[model samples]
Target: MSGVFQRISSIWREFCKRRAYGALIHPDGIAAQAEELARLADLALRSTAALSALECRHLAQLAQSMRQLRETAHSPEFCRLSADRRLALHRQLLTAREKLLASLQKTQISTEKLQ
Candidate 1:
């Protein structure tokens, strides 16, 4: 009976250790991810050949949002965020990427229009 109990306890401890390790997010990782997103947004803005007034405005807004996100990720407060909050921030980043892509797709000007 004692041996069985010890084995179960050891397994449970290992599982808990793995779970805790998986939950941690290094601050630098978050900062790097945010920077990459910002870079992509900036590249999209510069690479687009012809953006209408509305598209320009939308792109500007997206760029601002990306800047804010990057700033937030680098802040000390961000480092203190709970694991769940960090996860939520990661989800928000994904959503931001999708929005950026959608905005780019919508603003694509046909070559025929340019000519």
Candidate 2:
């Protein structure tokens, strides 16, 4: 099983447990995790990993999308979404980039903080 799937499973388990604790399950929780798992499956199927500069660009794009989505967190649209959904979606996208980037230290260059 892919790491994404494993993470999704972990998230689902936590979600279920939350519900058992009387917590409401966000309708979009599964969708977000499913999207993440699908993304990983797509990557594995294509066999294109962080091995190339293209993958680096792809990861960067994913990071930018995540940032934009997060910026929307304070928007009314974000408020409309369930809290679980927002957290799950953020976790999926961020974890995807983190896992992929962990594999390529050369490409995993970090920028210095500027004043």
Candidate 3:
């Protein structure tokens, strides 16, 4: 009986975690992320004269990924993902955004140095 209770408690905790994760990756959250990414990309492009070939390629790839993310966020399939899976997707999006921004910042600083 005690073991059964423990198992039930564990399951409940897992369910709650999933729900929280789902909320984090909800459409609204994705939309907000997409908007931020677009803003960042625009800023990077505005400084194209300071960017290297590699930086430009990275920005281009980032733009493509952002477009895909926007499309996925609007798709019915994305809406149906399990909360656990949604959390994973959210993390990936965040990581990608961070990397892109960091790369752009590094390029910007390097360009400024040449001035």
Candidate 1 regions exceeding 4 Å error are 1-24, 102-115
Q: What is the C-alpha lDDT of each candidate?
A: 0.69, 0.52, 0.74
Candidates 2 and 3 compared by lDDT, better number: 3
Q: After superposition, how far is residue 72 of candidate 1 from its true place, in Å?
A: 3.1
TM values, all candidates: 0.59, 0.39, 0.67
Tell me the lDDT of model 3 at 77.
89
Q: How close is candidate 3 to the true structure, as a TM-score?
A: 0.67
Arrange candidates, best lDDT first. 3, 1, 2
Q: Return the top candidate by TM-score.
A: 3
lDDT of 2 by residue, 35-110 (tens): 4544553444344433466655665565455445545545677556544565566566557656764554434333
Clashes of each: 0, 0, 0
Native-to-model Cα distance after best TM-score fit, residue 24 in candidate 2, in Å: 15
Q: Per-residue CA lDDT of candidate 3, range 1-115, in tens?
A: 9999999997897688767675677877886787678678866876656766776777777776776777778789887766677787778878878887677666634255655
Candidate 3 clashes between residue pairs 3 or more apart in a chain or in different chains: none
Question: Could you give candidate 1's per-residue lDDT for residues 63-90 as a string of tens digits?
Answer: 7776776677668887666666666666
